[model samples]
Target: MRIAITRRGYITELDGVNKFIFNLAEGLNQLGCEVHIISHALGGSQVSNIASYAEKFFDFQGKFQIHALPFSYTNDALALPLWFLNGSRLINKLEVDAVIINGIVPLNSRKVKIAVNHGIFTGSFLNTNRITQHIYLQFAKHIYLYGIDLTVCVSSKLKEELGKLLNIKSIVIPLPLKLNLYRTEPLGKRSPLVLHVGGRSSKNAEISIQSMKILNEKYDLDVKLIIVGHKNAYLESLSAKYKYMVPKTLEFYFDASSLVVRDLMANAKALILPSRYEAFSYVVLEALASGLPVVVSSAIPSELVKDGFNGFRLLQYDPNLYAKRIKALLTDDDMWDGMSKNALKTARKYSHIKVAKLYLHAIQDIMRMKLNS
Candidate 1:
């Protein structure tokens, strides 16, 4: 079947949604579906300063072709006029069986559009600054349900919120994974290293550091913490302070590649994610696939990790609690081995091949329904 998947903009500027779009397109292509990915001409954010975009680098490796049209820059004045003129013209011409939009957005397209909502990021912007968030929301609310045929939510948490925002029901689909790429040889003996997967506000990096500090001072645990991704001055100061207290106990990797993440996870004792809020985390799933037990918030979707089985799930940001959980795995070899084995089993369910087939079925089902009506 010929399928067209639409995304907001350029993939060079990375985020959770961009990565998901590429992975889905690749998975669909591998399954022998003719897939086409259409993206906006002008992309990026005003705050992040990712204003520049290129037509290339977001490669599908001969599986599909990327099409660029001026359907984005949603927060700007030119977006509506461009949509009514250029964007609408481009989308109406696509000769595809189904069109799936990658986010909870509406395009001025004639084709039956399926929207997949990733998160309430626009709503979350209020926590930082209200004025800019208010301005962005004004534009976003207009196109949320326009031309949408079906809506897909990635997690239960997101699905519930989408109902409140759009006042519409949506189907829930867990994030897909290319599990085979990350499968590696098990470590004979893992180092006492706990890996931190994110550095953003929602990632709760501050509390992660606090937890490690408690482990060091209170429990006298000689465990090393590996932080992967972005870090600000506050995180840097904390890391420096922790190192002064306990040398070589903390390490930070800035903007690491997939290979670096794999290498880190392979040797690490556990994957620690203390995110305050989330829709779904690909890192948590990937860590489990790499055979590392996770220490994360209970707020994280239960399907991703089961408490005490594949990882520890607790609500408290209490450093002592996190430290105690990490200590158990470090001190007990058998317990660690069992949890590691279970983690792999949990990850196996999210294999990309299975998810791609589901996508095919879902689109076909929706198309069939639309025709019947």
Candidate 2:
């Protein structure tokens, strides 16, 4: 079947959502489906000032075609409307079989439009602006829920929220991870290194840093925390103050092509994610696939990680408890080995081939419903 994927997120950066879109398109194409990915002309906030527009646009590669929609203004109000117009025009011109829109696209295309919900912007208990969160929820309702024929959520938690707001059920389809890209090798017992990966603005990073400090002071563990992503001034300041307690490393944003992340995850003893909220984290899946145990917040969906099995899930924002779990995993070799094995097993369930087939089936089901209606 011919399919079109639409996204407003940065294609230039190697963020979770972008990785999902790229991998989905590639997998679908390999399955003998005609796929086209339509993205916005602009990049993300972090790279907007540093990278050129052309540099941002040229970062993605796929088996199918990619169309970039140009916008006159950078503001959300202006950009959203323009993106809708441009995207609708492109869909009409292509005349594809179906369209999958990431986040929300205010387009009135005749083709079946599937809206993918990554997460709830408002319900997030993270350190985010209340006004901005409210505005985002309102926009999701107005643009996303009202504009799509079907909806898909990356996690059951997100699906529940969408069902409540839209008064319609959303299909739960976990994000796909390329398992072949990350393989397990006998890295042996890892060093005193804990890895945290993702954007710096996420409240999870703050929680992770705090947990590290607690672990350092309480257990006197000489562990090093390596945070890989765009560095924030606030995070940098925190790291500087706690430098004596824990050695920290801040790496700049890199694309998916960068091998540095794989090396970091493969060598780390554990991956700690104390996110206040998350739909699904591809990084955690990647770490697990690489034979690294994960420690996540309870707010993260249980399906993503099983506590005391593949990984440990802590109560929301409990830095001391999170630290204790980390210390135990770091200190106990037998426990760490068992958890690492379980993590690899869990990662297999999210294999790229399996996820690709699920997405294809969902799209076909949506199309069948449209036909019957």
Candidate 3:
């Protein structure tokens, strides 16, 4: 079977969506399917030149062919239409059995197309812009109902949201991570350290920081809050007032190629995610694979985390309770050990090979259904 995957983003970026595409493409190839990647050129002053774009393509080493579509406009709304035009032309030239679109975009084609829903627009609680939110919600609904033959959601929470919008249930497929790249290490004794992974604007980061402040004041505990990602001036200013609480360390965004994240996860006392919304978080999964306990918001699906077993779920943004959970995980050795073991066990189910088989099964079913129709 020949499959064509289309994405409207830079392939070299280490974001969750790009990571998903790279891993899925490699997995499909291993399953004996001829795969091709159709991507739009990232047009900025830095990479606007043809030679820069070609270099980016050469950086992506895969068993499949890559076709870069010419797009002059950088705005997604304008670029998407141009992408569809260029992609349609390429599809006519290649005999592909199916096309997998990574996001919601208007594409009128006869081939079987699948739309993967990472998160519904309505699920973003922190976004204050009403007009942009409405536009995104409308687009999601249109793509879910009319633009694609099948839709896949990364988490049950997101699946429920998609079902409500489309009036049809979406297939739930958890995001897969390369577990082999992250090994479970025995960090004998953990310090009073709370690790938060993501950008500053992330709701998860916000909740984690607030919770740490509560924990520090109540217990008078000396803890360090290490945030890995870009620093937001807004968050940084907020952190300044609570100088006596927990010491904050901001590490800017770095390449994922280094095993630094794995090392950090293995050594941390606990991973805390105060995200207001998420389809499925790669950081949480990576932390689990490293045998680290997690304290996440209740908004995240229970299937991905258990309240008392592998991780603690914060029902709402209560800084005091969130702090208490983190403190317990840090001080209580027996409870921490149990959660760590469970975390590793749960993470094994999301291995790359296992996820690859599930994706292949879905594609096969779609093909069979199309043939019968």
Report the number of the highest-lDDT candidate: 2
Q: How many clashes (backbone N, Cα, C below 3 Å) per candidate?
A: 0, 0, 2
Q: Which residue ranges in model 1 land beyond 4 Å of their true spot?
A: 41-62, 71-84, 121-124, 127-146, 184-187, 231-247
lDDT of 3: 0.72
TM-score, per-candidate, Cα-based: 0.85, 0.85, 0.84
Q: Write the residue-wise lDDT of candidate 1 on 1-373 in tens digits.
A: 7888777655454566766776677778788888777766444342233222221222233366566664456454565465556655666676777777764344566666777777775334646577766665554555554556677888888888767765767788777777766754455666778889776666776677777777777888887787877556756765676666444677778767666788788888887888877788888988888999889997688877788898899888777778788888777878888999999998888877787787788887877887898
**Model 3: worst 10 consecutive residues (lDDT sum):** 52-61
Q: What's the lDDT for candidate 2?
A: 0.73
What RMSD value applies to candidate 1?
A: 4.4
lDDT-best of 2 and 3? 2
Query: What are the C-alpha RMSDs, in order, of all predicted structures?
Result: 4.4, 4.1, 4.0
lDDT (tens digit, per residue) of candidate 2 on 1-373: 8899887755554566777876677678778888887875454553343233222422223466757677633566677777777879999899988888885768868887888878765233234587866676677777655677778898887788777865657788778776776756553645577888765456467667777777767788877777766556856766666566453432223232335677777778888888766777877888898999889987678887889998898876777888889888988888988988998888888866677798788778878887898
Candidate 3 TM-score versus the reference: 0.84
Score residue 360 of candidate 3 by CA lDDT: 73
- Which regions of candidate 2 are displaced past 4 Å? 43-61, 122-139, 142-146, 187-189, 214-217, 243-258
